[model samples]
Target chain A: MKNTAIEVLAVKNLKKSFILHNQNSIELPVFDNISFSLKEGECLVLAGPSGTGKSTLLRSIYGNYLTHFGEINIYHNQSWINLVEATPHSILNVRRQTLGYVSQFLRVIPRISTLDLVAEPLLEQGETEVHSINRAKDILQKLAIPETLWDLPPATFSGGEQQRVNIAITFVKEFPILLLDEPTASLDQKNKQAVIDLIINARDKGTAIIGIFHDEYVRNAVGTSIFDIEEAKHAA
Target chain B: MTMSLQNPLLKVENLSHYYGDQIGCENINFDIYNGEVLGVVGESGSGKTTLLKLISGLLCPNAGSVAFDTRIEGLRDIYKMSEPERRLLMRTDWGIVYQNPKDGLRMNVSAGANIGERLMAIGNRNYANIRSDSSDWLEKVEMDLERMDHFPETFSGGMLQRLQIARNLITKPRLVFMDEPTSGLDVSVQARLLDLVRGLVSKLGIACVIVSHDLGVMRLLSHRLMVMKSGKVVEQGLTDQVLDDPQDPYTQLLVSSILPV
Candidate 1:
C-alpha cells in the first residue's frame, strides 16, 4: 500500500542569505548547501530550533524565496522542473497544478466569502461553481468550521478559525506536493487532531509533504522522516 | 495552468510612453493568455492607466510594440495596423471598460441600446434578435428587465457600470481591458461587482488586463500580478506569491501597508 517510490521534490546544494543594505550591507546567512528529496506518501517534517531556517527551506522549495544558488527540482506536469531556474509563469503553473503551500498566516482578501475563498483554487481548475462550493463546504465541515461562517469573510474570524480556513483552502484540492508552515500553530487539541488527520490522509493518498510542526504529538502522528536543519547544517 | 501553455492572446514588449519629460510607463513587458486575468497595481501617478491605454490602443507607445493575436492576422503589432483595421479590432475583438461608466457608455442611449449598439456595429441588423440579446445580457449582469429601456442618466452609478459592462461584453470580445471597474463604489456594491466580474470573466473565458490600486481586488480577481513603481515594473508573479511573499521592497511596503481586519 505504500506508494513511496516516486520522488516528487528534490533540493540540492541550496543556499540563501539576506543582505541588509541600509545598515552597512550586513550579510545574514540563513541556510547553506541544504539538500533533500521527498517521495510520494512520505511526510518530511522540518525540525530545528528557532532561527534555524526551517521556514526558509520550505519557502525556497515553494519558490517564494530566491536562493543564492542550487536547484529546487519539482516533478510537475509529468516532467521535472528546476524551480530555481523556472520562469514566473512556470512557477505559477507548478503552484497551480503540482504544489500547494499553507503558510502560518492567511492573507485574507477583503469582501470574498470564506467559502468562495476556499473554493477559488478549484474554480481556477475549471470546476463548476456548484461543485467547487460543495467541495469547499465538505472541507470546511471536516475542519469543523461552522456553517454560519461560510458566507462571511475570514477576516473577522478568530486566529484558529482563520488558520483552519487557510488550511481548508490548500487541502480542498490535493496537490502532488504540499508545504505546511506551522499549519496547526493556532489551533486547540481537537482542531489540531483534525489537521493531523488531514495530513495523514493526504500522505496516504500519495502526497509528498514537507512541514514544520512545533507540536511533537502532531509531528509524530504524520511525519515519515524528520529533516533536522540544525543537524544537517552541522554535518555539512 | 493549461492556459499558460497556449500562445499568449496579447503581448507587450519594451512598451514605453512619455508625456514630454514625464514617463507614462517605460519598458513594460508581459503576456496575457486566454482566460487569464493580469492585474497592474501601483499608487496614483505610477503609470498603471498609461500602460492600460497604451496596450488597448487608446494611447500609442513611443518606443515599443503592442502585439495581439488577431483572428485575421496572428500576433501582429497593433500599432502597425491601419487605423481602420485597429478600430475594427477594437470594436469587434477587444473591450475597454473605463473607470467611469460615462466614459464607456453612450449616455444619450437607453441601457438596452447601449448593449445592442456593439452588436449593431458588427452588422446584427435584426431588431428582434438585438432586443432579445440585450435583455439577456441585462439579466446576466443582474439588472432589472424594466431598466433596459431606461436611459443611463436615470440609473445609479452601480447600475450604469453594470450596463457599460453588458455593452462591452455583448460583442463577445476576446480581450478586455478593465480600468478600476469597481472604484468609487460602495463597499457592498464593489463586492457584488467583483463577484460578477470574476464569474463572468471565467464563464466567458475572456483574457483580461485589469488595473487597480486596490490590492484586495487584485488578490481576488487576478491570476498574475505586475507591481509597477515610477513607470517601471518592479516585480511580476502569480498573485498569491507576490502578495504573500513579496520580494521587491516597493511590493513589500505595498502589501504591508494594508490594514489588517
Candidate 2:
C-alpha cells in the first residue's frame, strides 16, 4: 500500500437522475447519496453488476453529468474546487492540468494523425513538438501499436487498436487524478498486462485513480480498494 | 495548463442580438485565452454566424459587451470605441474569414497585393519587404510562388480559401474569426485545409472563434465547443467530452446524425 495522507478527490452526498423530457418528463434515478474519497497513490475500483450506475458515478465525478444534489470536490493546483459548482472554463482548466479521463471509446477530430492525437496533451502542457512527438512514439510503441499505423487516423483502426490509442493518449502524460472506464475491455491478454503495468506505475507515482473494470483479473491487479455501488445503495 | 493561467485575450458577456422581434443570438457569454480555439456549432440559423458577427464588431448587439485586451488600452468594450479606433483594431489586431472567400478577398487585386495590403495598412512601406513577406505567406499556405500575381477569381475554390487564409494571417492577428472555413470543398481538400488551419493556429498562437456546422471540424481544431440550438447555447464543454458523451438531447441527436463513411 502507498501513503494515503493527501486527498486528491472527494464526493459527498451525490445524487443524479435522468429526466425523459420528451416522454412526459419521466424520471429515472441512477444513484443517490453516493459518497467516496480518494487519496494520492490509491486506486478505487468501482465494483458492481451491470446497470448499477458504476459508469454513471464516474461520469458524475468527471462533471460530464449534472447531479441533482451533492459536491464533487477536487484538490488541484494547491486549491479545492467543487466540480459541481465550477464554471465550464475552470472545469476545462482543471481537466487540462490535474484530471485525465480515458473513456470507453476514442473521440477525436477527423484527419488528425494518430501520432499528433496522442502527443496533443503534452503539447498543451507547453512541451516542444519534437519532444512531445518522441514521447508519444515511445508510449505508442509500448502499447504495441504498430509503427505503420501511427501515421494514420484511429477512425479506421480496429476496436482493440482504437482502445489502445485511447489508453495511450491518457498515459502519455502524468495526471494527478485519473478516471478510466473499461480501458482494457477490448484489449487482449498482452495489451491487458501492459495497461495493468501502466496503472501500477501511475499509482506508485502518487496518482489517484478511479476505474470500472469488468475483468476480475484487472480489478485484482490494480485496485487498492473496491467501492461496490450496489452495496452502498443497499446500505443507504 | 499555461493557457488558463493567463488573462483572457477576448471576453464576451451576455451578448444578444435581435433583428426586430426575431432573435439572432441570445444571452451568449464566453472568454477566449491566447492560443485557444473556441468552436461554435449549430444547424442553419442557430445564430452561429450572428454570434461571430457580434463579437467581430461587424454587427452591433442589443445587449452585452465585447471586451478585448488591446495593446494600448488594457481591456475595453469594443462596441463603445470610436469608429476609427474600431476599424484600426480590425485592420491591425484582428482578422475575419467569411464563409464565402469572395466576401473577404479583393477580386481585382493580385494574390500578392491582397496579402501585402495588411502590412501596408500597418505602415510597412519598403517594397522588397512587403513583396518578400507576401511570398513567404503564400508559400506558408502551400500556394505556389508562381501564382503570387494571379487573381483570386482564376483560382479554384480550395485555392481561393487558402489565399484568404494567407491574407488573414499575414498581419499575425491575435484573434481570428472563421465562418464555415472548410465547407463547400471536396473532402480531400477540406482535410488538407483543416490540417493547414490547425498547424497555423498552434504555430502562431492565435486565438480563434470558428463557427462551423461540421462536427469533424470542431473536433479537429477547437479545444472547447458551444452547441447552439435555434438562438440559444444548449451546451458547452471541452470538445472531446461534449462530443463523446453529449449531455443535451439536441447535441446527442446532432452527433448521432452523422453517417459513418
Candidate 3:
C-alpha cells in the first residue's frame, strides 16, 4: 500500500554561507538550494563525509542558524509557518510543543537538581510539582540514574551521567518534530542501545525525526530513509 | 522455516470465549515458538486482554484448545490440566507482567522478598543466596540494591515497574506474557522501561506474548505482529511487514493514526 504520510516539515530553496575570517573574510558557500520534506513517523538521516554542513543544515531547519536564506516551513497548529521568517515569540511557541532539538552538549543549569531539570518541561506544561517530580523520577530510573543522585546537581556527575540527564530532560515531553545530534555520543554500549530504543520508539509514535548519527549501528537500527547532504548540494 | 519443523512452545487453535452473551474473542488461532516475541495489538475492548487471559489459563475459554508443551509433560491442553499442574507451570516456567505494578507486585513486602518469593517458589531456600541473587537482579534492572529492603509502596512507579520485572524474571521463566508493560508512564519513562525490557527479554532468550494498544512498543519488541479488531485478528505477519505495509484496512488505519514524535 502507498504510504498516506502527512508532510510535517518542508524546506525550500535553502542556502547557507559562512564568512571565512582567515582568508580575508571570504563568503564561502556551505550549501545552496537544499530542499527536502519530512513526513510524520518518518526518520530522515543526514549522511555524508564530514565538512558537508550536515549539522548546519539540521540547525538551520531548527531555526538556530539565523543567517540562513531559505524557508524552513513547519506545519504547526493547522498551518505551515516558515521558521526563517518566524518571530521569536512564534518560534518559542512552536518549540514549546512542536519542535525538540537535542544537541551534542547539554546546557546545564548550575544549581538545579537533576530531577528538577528533567521535570522543567512538564512544569511548563502546567503539570503539578508533585506529578512532574514523580514523572521525572521515573525517567531517571529508566536511564539507570540512581535515586541518591537525583536531588543533586548534574554538574559534578560523570560524562555519561550528565548525558543521561540531558536525554532524560529532552525526551520527558513528546514533541511533534525531533532533531537529534549524536544523541548517543558519550553513552556506553548498553546505554547506547537504550538511546537507540528510545529513538525507535519516538519514530514509531509518528514523530518526524531528523538526526545526525555517527554510529552505524544506531543509523541502521532506527533510520527509515537517508538524506545525503552531498546529494542535496549536488542534485540537479 | 526451521521453526515449523520444531514443535511450538504453545499452539492456540480456534480459541473462543464469551462474557455472558457478548463475545470476548472468537476463533483466535496462533502459535508461539521458543525465543519468540509475539505482539497482540488492538483497541480497548477488541478482546486482546480476553485472549491473553484465556490462553494463560486465568479465564476459561468457551471453546477451542490451548496446547502448551511443558518441560515435564509433553504437549498437554492447558484447560485440561489439573489446577495444581497448571499452577506449577505458571510458577516455574511462565511469567506474567501486568500493566499495573500493584497487580504484579506485593506492595507490603520488601522489594527483595518479592523477587525472592519467585525463587523460593522454584525451590531456592538458602536465605543468603536469595538475598545475593535479588541484589544482582536489582542491579540488572538498574535499580539500587539499597532499595531491596524498601516496600514497593515506597518505590517510584518506574522503580516499581523495574522491580516487578526483576521479580518476574528472577525464576528465569521460559515464557512470559506482558500486558501494556509501559502504558502507565510518561513518554521518556516508557521509553526507558521499554528499553530495559527489550534488552532483558533478548539477553535471556525468552518467548513472550505481549499485548498493547501502543504500536510503538509492539514494533520495537515483537518479532511477529497480530492486529486485532472487534474480537478478531485483521492481520498477522512479521513485525516490520505488518507495521510498515499493513494490508488490512483496520491495520492501515491503526498504523496511520500513530502521532509521530
Q: For this target, which candidate reaches the highest TM-score against the unseen true structure?
A: 2
For candidate 3, the per-residue lDDT at A183 reads 87
Off by over 4 Å in 3: A1-236, B1-5
| TM-score of each model, in listed order | 0.91, 0.92, 0.54
The C-alpha stretches of model 2 lying farther than 4 A from their native spots are B234-261
DockQ for all models, in order? 0.33, 0.34, 0.02
Worst 10 residues of 1 chain A by lDDT: A18-27
Cα lDDT tens digits, model 1, A191-223, are 999999999999998999999999999999999
CAPRI grade of model 3: incorrect
lDDT of model 3 at residue A228? 90
Docking quality band of candidate 2, CAPRI definitions: acceptable
Chain B TM-score for all candidates, comma-separated: 0.98, 0.98, 0.96
In model 3 chain A, which range of ten residues has the least summed lDDT? A18-27
- RMSD of each candidate? 2.5, 2.4, 18.0
- Greater TM-score among 2 and 3 belongs to 2
Candidate number that wins on lDDT, 2 or 3 = 2
**lDDT tens per residue, model 1, B122-241:** 889999999999999999999999998899999998998888889999998999999999997998888889888987887788989999999989998898899999999999987877
**Residue lDDT tens for model 3, B183-205:** 88887778678767766765676
